[model samples]
Target: MDHDHTLFHRDDVVALRHDLALSLRAAAHHGLGEGICNHFSVMLGGNSGLFLINPHGLHWAEVGPDDIVLVDERGERVAGAHGVERTAMFIHAAVHKLAGKTCVLHTHMPHATALTVTPSGKLNTKLSQNAMRFHRRVAFDADYNGLAFDETEGERIAAALQGADVAFLANHGVVVCGESLAAAYDDLYYLERACQLEVLARSMGGGLAEVSDQVAEATAAQFARDRDQSRLFFEALRRELPLP
Candidate 1:
């Protein structure tokens, strides 16, 4: 488990570090954090399989740019702190290595977690336009094997992603991956909105009103073709929570 020095080169290093810190702060602001748990990581570049992660046990608010650590795809901490979070190594490292996802963000946000504890633990896709966007995009990992502290568990969770960008972990929280930090952050925001709307709508005791399959498919397609707006979305959010 030796660290690779080549992975720590200066290319895009500052930007990645800033974005990682900004997202953690945003997570804290949006109430996506649960104490000092969960993790946000971004792959440095293609093929290198090197990435940066927030410090283990550092509350989201306290995770500044200098606090992020570097690790290789094999879950080895090549730079920064002596140890990274076990679950981060298991989950983020596995997905970035196997699935080639650039950004792997997991959060135990309230609404997202609520969906996992339900009987089906599925995202109610028919709830809203936000919900419809996840109609065919949401992946579910019904096997809640407690905390992921090893490579095997990480592999299982990555397999569950099944090429999908978002996953709802039953009895747990959620994982969302994207080709860029911006895409991942945008999806994370919309997903929380989708889950929150569904939970609130269902809790009213008035049963549920759902959109049709055709509309859902069409709407999801619209979201899929929304790649151009992802930057704008993340920029807007970052603006709302401007960092010094």
Candidate 2:
């Protein structure tokens, strides 16, 4: 374990790690993690060549800035003190390679996973903040073979995510990727919240009704405008995590 600081000292990786750790912990705290599985990563520099990811088998709530493993664009461990998670490298590595996204957050939460098990994979949007974010940023991947280990499966998942900021992995979970960790985490958090609400609404036997299109559009615009404020949420989560 070469725990060298030089590899992660770059402003880009540091900011990414800090923000990602925060988001990971938040996801775990909100019930998005399955013990030690699930993973998150963000690209380094401009090439998406050296991304930051968590070491395998670590609880999401227990991860910190120093716990990240730096992996090259092809999923090979490039730096840092620990090794990469096999599944994470296989899935996220392929995504950054083919999709060219900077931030990728994958998790398995209860409500969202339930939605994926169905054929429709539809999330009822009934005017709540949860529904508003799901208006258009979400995508549903109906096919689930198994854990992503090959480039082709990862590419297929990425294809399902095309034009979608947040995607539901059929019979598995959800994946959200964005330009930054804050943006990605914000989307992930809201997606889970929305799913939880939808589950609750459906259990009552009354089908949910969506807010008018005009209202939905307006609320989504407001969420877009408040993107800057999402930074504060991430910051607060950072303060609560197990810092290094």
Candidate 3:
């Protein structure tokens, strides 16, 4: 997995590293990341068979561009000062390879993980405008075998995605994927918000008001057309945070 560090210095690759690091910091800031567990990854440009991931042992709050580890599809460290976590390797590499996602974000954020443990085992997309944005874009994995200890487990999780951009892993966390980091991160943020609202609403003792499928689908499409907002939101994060 060792490679010339020179190749990692390409302008686009550097930018991706910065953006991924900033995203980790943002996730930490927003309480989307747990201790040193959840991982985020981005495929290296142009089908390079490599990706950047946060090194193990570093909290998301302190991750920086240089802390991002470059690894091959097999999860071997190609260039970095630290080692890759075992679950991160299996999960992220499989998602990038099997799901063909350019950006893969996995987190155990409180609200979303709370939904995963419920009987419904997935988000109720009809519950809120934020949830509506995820209508028809979510897949559910009802089986919770255990931790992803190997490649097959990772592949199973990827297969569960079933071409959807969001997946709620039974008894686990959630995975959010997108063609770009900004778009995926946007989904991650709002997804947690939606789930938080649902949890709060359920606590109020009244039946949840639901939106019709037709309305949810239309709302999703409307949100889809505002893709620029994702980019702008990420830009706003960069402006507000001390990322450099």
Q: Best TM-score goes to which candidate?
A: 3
Q: Model 2 Cα displacement at 109 (Å)?
A: 1.0
Lowest summed lDDT window (length 10), candidate 3: 1-10
TM-score (C-alpha) between model 3 and the true structure = 0.97
Q: Which candidate, 1 or 2, would have the higher TM-score against the true structure? A: 1
- For 1-244, candidate 2 gives per-residue lDDT tens digits of 3334476777866777777777777888887889888889888765536788988878988888878888776677767777777778777877787777888888887887888877768565544776786577777778888878777667777888777777788888888888878788878887778888888877899967777887887888888887886778777776776466
- Quantify all predictions' global Cα lDDT against the true fold: 0.84, 0.78, 0.92
Alpha-carbon shift of residue 142 in model 1 (angstroms):
1.1
Ranking by TM-score: 3, 1, 2
Best by lDDT: 3
How high is the lDDT of residue 113 in model 3?
A: 96
Error of 1 at 167 (Å): 0.9
Candidate 1 C-alpha lDDT tens digits along 1-244? 5545654556678678888888889889888889988889998865676789988878888777778888877767778754687888898888888877889999998998899999979788877899887887788888888789778877888899888888888888999998888888888888999889988988888978888999999999998898778898778867887766
Q: Which ten residues in a row have the lowest lDDT in candidate 2?
A: 1-10
TM-score of each: 0.93, 0.91, 0.97
Q: By the lDDT metric, which is better: model 2 or model 3?
A: 3
- Supply candidate 1's per-residue lDDT for 21: 86
